[model samples]
Target: MNNEVIVTCAVTGAGDTVGRHPAIPVTPQQIAAAAVEAAKAGATVVHCHVRDPASGKPSRDPELYYELVDRIRASGVDMILNLTAGMGGDLEIGPGEEPMRFGPGTDLVGGLTRLIHIEQLLPEICTLDCGTLNFGDGDQIYVSTPNQLRAGAKRIQELGVKAELEVFDTGHLWFAKQMVKEGLLGEMPLFQLCLGIPWGAPADTGTMKAMVDNMPPGAIWAGFGIGRMQMPMVAQAVLLGGNVRVGLEDNLWLDKGVYASNGSLVERAVDLVAKLGANTLTPEQGRKKLGLIKRR
Candidate 1:
């Protein structure tokens, strides 16, 4: 088991969860507060995604991201910021035989466009959803082709940002390794094994282990599962010699009936890590462990 772990809290994801939860941190101030709460509760890193404050829908607006990052930085918290570059790839296909008719949910854009916020904000860490996947049981698909990934990786390298390669399936992991081999990702690129999403890798021991086994040698990696499997996968990831992630973005309920905030979820993860004979690292320690280059 890894003795020192990096616990990352994904504060607010770009999911359709505003109505499901009473408070989902739609505005930038709320999101920044959530990040500070998580940091105070023992989260080493914060993965952020901006939402349209009015509609609570996922947005790729650079202004929203700018305001969100500004709030986080101004809060005086020492949490490592990891902005998501996974937006702008949602393609909701039309119902029935009219596949050519894209639905209103479609928000497709070029790969470079997705990095506008990253280019502007220059956070210490950024995520790259390594491959395309069927987002859910619906017709929506998350598109990140090899060409897009290569270009994004190169740009991220040039900007000197740590790319957290998020792999949803074995194929995605395979391609991520290919990118590393091609040297698009700079030395010490991080990997995040995303599990329990629809039509992707399931949340299970064998699946997590299989993905961990396939990881490139000496590659720093972490994993998380969604819903009820979230905490369980925390233990599994640590036991399998990997790091852990947890937050409302991946799981809503802290317990069977209890609602969860980002802080509470991260506290639970820290407790779990301690009980497992391991400890979660602080932000500075996490940066050193992951070889991260922190920006203001």
Candidate 2:
């Protein structure tokens, strides 16, 4: 395993995790606080998702993103900000009786409209979910087609933001490479191999290896798994010559019956990386590795 590894803490996900953990940060202030805590715990980057202050549901509000970024910067914690531009592409189709009809929980928007936060805040890194997937336990789908992805990537690139090509499976990897080939991404393409998110890729060594092997040449990448596979994938990612990501977004439990705070999850990943004889990268170091430029 390489001695240098970058650790990213996905502070708050756009999932139904608020009900599972009472401490999950719903408000912008709480999310920023959690991110600051994770940075203090040795995370190189904080992957973010803003939630509605009133309903505790996910939101694509630009003001919330601005507020979170402002607070993180004000706290004086040096960490890379990675905002998600993947939220506004959801398509929750109704059951067979009304398959084509818009469902009750649908929140679909155009690709450009989805990136309002990234456009305004101009963070160093923003996620570009490479393709669509049938999200777990629901008839809902996270839709990101080829054309939609192309538009998102083009917009982020135009803004001089590094795109974290988030790939859930091999197909996503293929599309990401296609983006690189089409000049949508920069020379040193960056990728995040997301594993074990329900109906997507399975959380295992073989699956991780396949994703890593299929990565485009000259690409910088990170790999992570959900729940029990979290720490295990940390080791696996190190062995595979990639960075690691950990947080409540992917896993809710610290143990069998324990709910984990974002800070504790990041601390656990730090220890695991150290135990493997690897040194975790700081935010600045990670920026250089991933070809990210921190713009104020």
Candidate 3:
């Protein structure tokens, strides 16, 4: 088991959890507060996603991102910030015989267009989802083609930001490694093995171990599962010699029938890491572990 753990709290995500949870970090202020709370609860990294403040829907507006980042910075918190570039890829295929019609959820855009905020803000780390997948039981699809990924990777490299490769399955991980081989994501690649998302890799020991086994040499990797598997995967990931991630982005409950805030989820993860006989890393230690220099 890994003795030192880096806990990353994904404060808010693009999922439709705004209405589901009592507190899902809708506005910039709320999201920033959530990040601060998670940091205070011992999260080394705060992975954030901005929302449409008025509608509480996921958004890719650079202005919203700017406001969110500004608030987090103004809070005087000392945690690594990781913004999501996984937005603008949702292609909600039309139901029935009109797959071409595209639903209102469709937000498809060019890969580089998705990184507009990343380019402008230049956080310490940003996510690059490695592949496409049929998101959920619905007809929605998270579209991240190889060409889009290549262009996105190139842009991220040029901006001199650390790319957290988000691999939803083995193929995504495969392509991620290929990007590293092609020198698209710099020398040392950081990976986030996302699991338990529908139609992707299931949350299980075998699958997590397999992904860990296939990670490129010297790859700094972390893994997490969605929903109820979130905490379990934290321990599983640590046991497998990888870091861990937890937060409202991947789950909304602290326990059965109990709602969770970002801070509470992070506290739970920290306690789990300790129980595993490993100590959670501080922001400075985590930055050093990931070779990240805080940039804005």
Candidate lDDT scores, in order, read 0.93, 0.90, 0.94
Sort by lDDT, best first.
3, 1, 2
Q: Find the candidate with the highest lDDT and give its number.
A: 3
Error of 2 at 26 (Å): 0.6
Alpha carbon lDDT at 139, candidate 2: 89
TM-score per prediction, in order, is 0.99, 0.98, 0.98
Cα lDDT tens digits, model 2, 5-25, are 999999889998878887889
Off by over 4 Å in 1: none
For candidate 1, lDDT tens digit of each residue in 7-67? 9999989888898988788898888899999999999999999888888888989999999
Worst 10 residues of 1 by lDDT: 287-296
Q: Model 1 Cα displacement at 185 (Å)?
A: 0.7
TM-score of 2: 0.98
lDDT of 2: 0.90
lDDT of 1 at 29: 84
